[model samples]
Target: MAFDEGDAPGRVVNGLSVDVEDWFQVGAFEGVIERDSWGGLDDRVERNVHAILNLFDEAQASATFFTLGWVAKRHAGLLREIAARGHEVASHGWDHERVFRMDRKSFAADIERTRKTIEDCCGERVIGYRAPSFSIDQRTPWAFMELAEQGYLYSSSVAPVAHDHYGWADAPRFAFNPLPWSDLVELPVTTAQFRGKRLAAGGGGFFRVLPYAFSRWAIRQVNRDEGRPAIFYFHPWEIDPGQPRVAGAPLRSRLRHYTNLEKMAGKLRQLVREFAWGRIDVIAHREALRLEAEKATLHRASA
Candidate 1:
């Protein structure tokens, strides 16, 4: 159902999120770089994160940072900095392990560890999660059950697009409760329908590869036409044009990862300026209240 602007009477507030992981730790490079070797790599995350923080500050916007537990363990101060700036801290898993790559037991342990690490570092409850590379699809539907059980209020792990590596093509394009009995909300990554096709406008490689105007138009369409807040996400590495390039990754991986790195930060600034932004928790609460009100109305009508 299309939400009408008359219902809200203002610009829709979109969600801004960042996946905190180094360039080499990206899923495309997992085949080449072992987790054990990550420590030996140059620590560029601090500088890159600082850049993003500065950008957000300039925009006077708040965002949710879905950070890696492994990064928090090593750079607790960084997570604290994010919280001090008033942005929400959430989990991006203990490491960069994809949900499908792990079994139930392992996935539980991974999220639990990450939650603890983030909470311990920032002293704030980590109530949201976005699986690495949008990996929580039908094959890993149990991931949602685990997320709710583990205290996550919502997840932004499903991308409703067709891709070689990951996507759930038929998933709902807006925020939704995946199960009737579960409290967990599944906020799929934002996509905009264009020329009879649903396109990825929620950032990552799409934000980089596509012209910034395309993303801008897509997000505008979602906000104005659909009247729902769009969830836009990007990686810290996307803004770091000087980050070390991975060697020997497949041709496709290289193109997806390295394209338009230098232009990302500028495009992000434009995006932040163009739209209202909020944390995932804010959207979840609003959606929950709307659902509750709808249920109450239905009950009164039935009575």
Candidate 2:
């Protein structure tokens, strides 16, 4: 399908988020690092997250932290710190389990566990969720119902780009309701229309691998040209270039994970400074308001 053309004006606020997981917990390292041995690894998540908090504070930007159930269980204080420091805390599911790898029951339990753990730590409801690897595509159509049922107001788990590991190539690039009967919003991570092709313009490895100038241009396209809020996310470990490396991992995985580590913080600072950033909850609330206004307008048109 063709990309959604921009209709609104240029001044749009984008959403910033962090997938709060340790360096060892990433899917790229799952092959080399077993879950049982995770505890023994050097954990830089807390220190890295604190550094991120400091960065955001310096930039005067707000963001959402989609934390893991396991991470929250271990770092309850850090979870609370994220909330206390003026950012929203949401769910990134138990561990880094992908949605397509589980049944409905398991997925539901995972979401419940993650959300409850985050709320318990922060003492605030976790109404937003992002599937571990943006795995809520064609295979998991029922995922939205589960999220809505579990009291989640929205999800940012789908990136509408073509990819080998994760991407719903045909899904809408912006936020939309996947279910007709529910109000749950699927807020996709940002992607850019590069010469009629959808490409990863959001955060993560793509943001790292690509030139900062291109990333900057794409985000400006989404904000000023598309007139929609772009959702960008990265992990706490991305900034921690000094984290221990996983030996004997796939060359691609190692490259994807480790590349641009030293450059991540500088690029992030520039990106944050260049655009307006806010929490995912704020974006969801604005989406709700926009939908309501559209409904009202349609009602008036019919009357």
Candidate 3:
């Protein structure tokens, strides 16, 4: 579909994304649940994703799935199903490794493995990425340079909020080129100013813990007030309240991971129904291309 066309002036097309990983793969459970044990765990991803696909269908929305290569290798059929249903299939790295933990070589290999796995699974070139846990931050600004060098068209790995685990609190709240002359657009996760502080408005734990009414209002404020589409994301496990709880996780991790799972699917339905949603490439590529053209034009005029 031509996402660049068919929008009225100033219309906001919000992005809906799903981080395609199982409950056991979440960063909160990393220390508690070893990666080696991932295979033995019961697979709830297919069931959960099928439910999500149905929800999107009901809302007449399309989304981008930032799928893990490990999950894609194990659940290729599910990955294919995401593409068949008209959603964009992108990489979420080979494993759930945080970008900050990997050296340059390891990071390159991880992205290549994921890009190939996703392209092979969905038969589409993967151009977008979201780091595990939003791992890209100020110290690892090279992550953006690497993404550009590795042929990524855009990235949604930065969350412009302060967090112990990951965030670049001062990054642009909306999409912008990370490098002055590169085409690689960095679309940070959505945030809204609240009481003189930036609060997480993008979906995930924030979406689960906060009242649905508040999330709805926050997203609307981004679109209507800020005149920019909000980038909302969630995990399939988020909708599976019955999923097994990790035993050894800290109290804080447990609370963050398990809160309001049952309500997530319904809230997602309402969110999609209430806004115009599309794949990230469909929504952000045009802007990136426009910026590149403007830069080239200015360079020529200056020269």
> TM per model?
0.94, 0.94, 0.94
- lDDT for each candidate structure: 0.87, 0.88, 0.89
lDDT of 2 at 2: 18
Displacement of residue 218 (Cα, Å) in model 2 is 0.7
* Runs with alpha carbons beyond 4 Å of true place in candidate 3: 4-10, 293-303
By summed lDDT, the worst window of 10 consecutive residues in model 1 runs over 1-10
Candidate 2 per-residue lDDT over residues 169-233, each given as its tens digit:
99988878788778888899999887799989899998988899988888888877877898999
Question: Compared with the true structure, what per-residue lDDT tens digits does model 3 show for residues 30-103?
Answer: 99999999999989999999999999988778899999999999888888899999899999998899999987
**Worst lDDT 10-window in candidate 2:** 1-10
User: Candidate 2: global Cα-lDDT?
Assistant: 0.88
Query: Which residues of candidate 2, in runs, are more than 4 Å off?
Result: 1-10, 295-303
What is the TM-score (0 to 1) of candidate 3? 0.94
